[model samples]
Target: MEEKCLNIESKVVHGHSMFDPLTGAITTPIYQSATFRHPGLYETTGYDYSRLQNPTREELEKTIASLENGKHGFAFSSGMAAITTLIKLFNPGEHIILSDDLYGGTYRICEEIYKRYGLEFEYVDTSSIDNLKAAIKSNTKGAFIETPTNPMMKVTDIREASKICKESGVLLIIDNTFLTPYFQRPLELGADVVVHSATKYLGGHNDTLCGLAVVNNDELAEEIKLIHKSEGAVVSPFDCYLIIRGIKTLAVRLERHEENAKLVAEFLKNHESVDKIYYTGDTDNPYYDVMKKQSSGFGAMISFTVKKVETVEKVLKSVKLITFAESLGGVESLITYPVVQTHGAIPEEIRNAIGVTDKLLRLSVGIENVNDIISDLNQALI
Candidate 1:
C-alpha cells in the first residue's frame, strides 16, 4: 500500500492495519487464536499458528520495519531475548567486540551466557575509530555498540565504525534503544542491523516488555527469524498490540523527551553540587560533534555525577516528581544510580574505567512540563 512514500511521523501513527472488515475498527484486533483454519490442502492465504506468526504481530513488525527503514523486523519476548538471538548467529569460539560502557544486562549476556558456550568478547572504548581498530582480532565476527552508551552518554562514530567493520569482515550491530529510530536511523548510518528494547522508548509508556531487531540485509533477517522461532522468545499478540499503540505517539513523545532532557542537562551543568554532566545535546560535551553528524537529535537520556555519593542519594530521595527507577525511555521521568542499578553487573574496576562512578546519576527525561521538572531537580538539589 505504498508504505515507503509515507513520512516517519505518519508511519508511526498509521503504518500497518489489520482491521475487522465487518466492524471497521480503527485498531487492529488481537487475533488471539492459537492457529488459523485451513480451507483446503492447497491453501492460498498464509495464516499459521500463534507461535510461528500472528496477524496482529505481523502488522506491528511491518510498522516497525517501515519506521526503521529496514527490510524486516522481528519482535521478541524481551530485550535480552532479542539480543541473545542476534548473538547466537556467531558460532562457539567466535569473537565479538563491544563498547566498554554497555548496558549491564547486555554485558552479562555476553560474559555469562555466551562465554559458557565458548564465545569470547572484548570491551573497548568505541568512541574512537582507533580503539575499535586496535581491538579487532582475526576471530572477531561482530561489533555490538551502544552509542550514547549507557550511563556515560558517550557517542560513537557509527559511520566510521561501520566502515571498519565492513573492511574487516565484521558485522556491525547497534542497540538503537537510547535514541530510537525517531531520532537516529542506524541503518542509514551503515549499520548491518539495529536492535531495540521495545520495553523502553518504543513502547513509550512502560506497559509491556518487547524487543525488536531490524536488518538491512534479507539473509541476516531470515537467520535471526529462524533463531527467534527455534528459541521461541516471541512476543505475545497482546503485547505486540500494546507496542503498536505506544509507537503511534513515538515522534511526539521523543520531541518532548529531547526538549525536557536538554533543560535538565542545562540545569545540572550550572548546579554547584554537580561535578560533571554528560549529555550529547550540550555543545561542550565531547560527543556533541559526532552526535550532530549521526543523529537528528541528541536524545532524551542524560548522565551526570554529583559532588559525592551522599549528594546523589539525597537528590534521588528528595525528588518529588521524578521516579527513582531502573528502566529509562518511558513517559514518566526516571533517575537511576548506574553503579547500583543499570551497570551493577559490571565489575567496579571496569565500571570506573568506563566512567560509571558511584556518584553518577542517569536520568531518562519524560515529556513533562519543563519548569516543573527543573523545579523538582532544583528543590531536590537544595
Candidate 2:
C-alpha cells in the first residue's frame, strides 16, 4: 500500500494527518481541553486556549487552506460567524460591493447590523462586470461574490472580477459554499479570501455546523486571527473533526451529486409544469461557459419555477423520497422554497427583483440512485 494518498482526493483524506506522532493513530484526536498547561512561566506548547486554537481544529483549517490554495484558514462555530468576522475586516466608512441574490442571512447582516454601524454596501448583479464597476464607490474596500449564487445559481466570472478589484485596490472575497473547494478553488483565480458554510457542502452530512475562511496572504490571516480570537466563536474540536471527516469523501460525494443533478435538470426541462430551470450543467444556461472556465464541475443545487404558484404547495407536499428541509449537501435529498425559507429575510421587493418568487423551488440534489431521484420528482410535478 502507498505510504500516503498523493492525489487531491487522497490528500484530502490523509494530508493533514494529525495522527498521533505519539501513537500512530489514523485520525486526529480532539484536544478537548479549554486551556493547556505551559511548559514553564515563559515557555509554551504553541497552544494556550481553545478559543485561540486547538490541534484538531488546526488540522481542519490547514487541510481546508491547502484545498483552497490559500496560506491560512480559520474555522468558526457557524457559517454566519465566519461571515461576520470577514465583515469586521472593514471599518465604519468602508464599503463592500456584493451580489444582490445572496443568502438572505448575509443581506440581513449588511442591512440590519453593518448598515447601522456606517459600513455601507451596494448590491448588484455581479455576473455583469459593468454593474460591479459602476457600483464601486471611493470608500469601497472589497468586492464579495457568490459565484453560483444561492437559489439563483448565477455564475460570476471570478478572474474578470478579480482583475477589476485588483485594478481598483480592493479585496476580492468569495463565498464558496455552493461549489466547495472540491469543485472550485476561488483563491487560485485571484480571490483574496474564500469562505465556506461547512454546514452545507464542506460538512457534507448536514450533521454539523461550522464555517471556514481562507486568506491568500499572511497579513490578512493575522488580521482575521485577531477577530476570530476576540469574538470567541471558534468551532468546537468535535465539529472540526466532523468536518475533517466529511472532507475526506468530498470528491466521491460531489461526483455523485453532480451526476444526479444533471439528470434532474434534464427531467425538469422537459416537464410541462416547469417554467424555467437554473442549473449550470446545461450548456444553454446563461453562465455555462463561465462556470466551465472556473469550475471542475457544475454544483448539485438546482432551482426551478412552476407554471402556477398553486402547484408549488402540491409539489412540496408530494415528494416522497426527498425531504423538505432548510439545509443541503447530505446523502439524503432536500427541497426548499427559497422565498419563504432561505431568502425570506430579504425584502419582498428585492427578492422579487432578483427572481426569488413563490413559484420557485430549490433542490439540493443528493447522492441517490438517479432513477429513484427522478421518479420522486416526476410524481411530485404531476
Task: Provide the clash count, candidate 2.
Answer: 0
The candidate that achieves the highest lDDT relative to the unseen native structure = 2
- Give the TM-score of each candidate: 0.97, 0.97
lDDT for each residue of candidate 1 in 156-237, tens digit (9 for 90 to 100): 9999999999999999999999999988999999999899999999999988999998997888888997888777899999
Return the top candidate by TM-score: 2
For candidate 1, give the lDDT of residue 244: 91
Give the Å shift of residue 77 in candidate 2. Answer: 0.6
For model 2 the local lDDT of residue 72 reads 94
Residues 186-219 of candidate 2 have per-residue lDDT tens digits of 9999999999999997789999999999997898
Q: Give the TM-score comparing model 1 with the true structure, all chains together.
A: 0.97
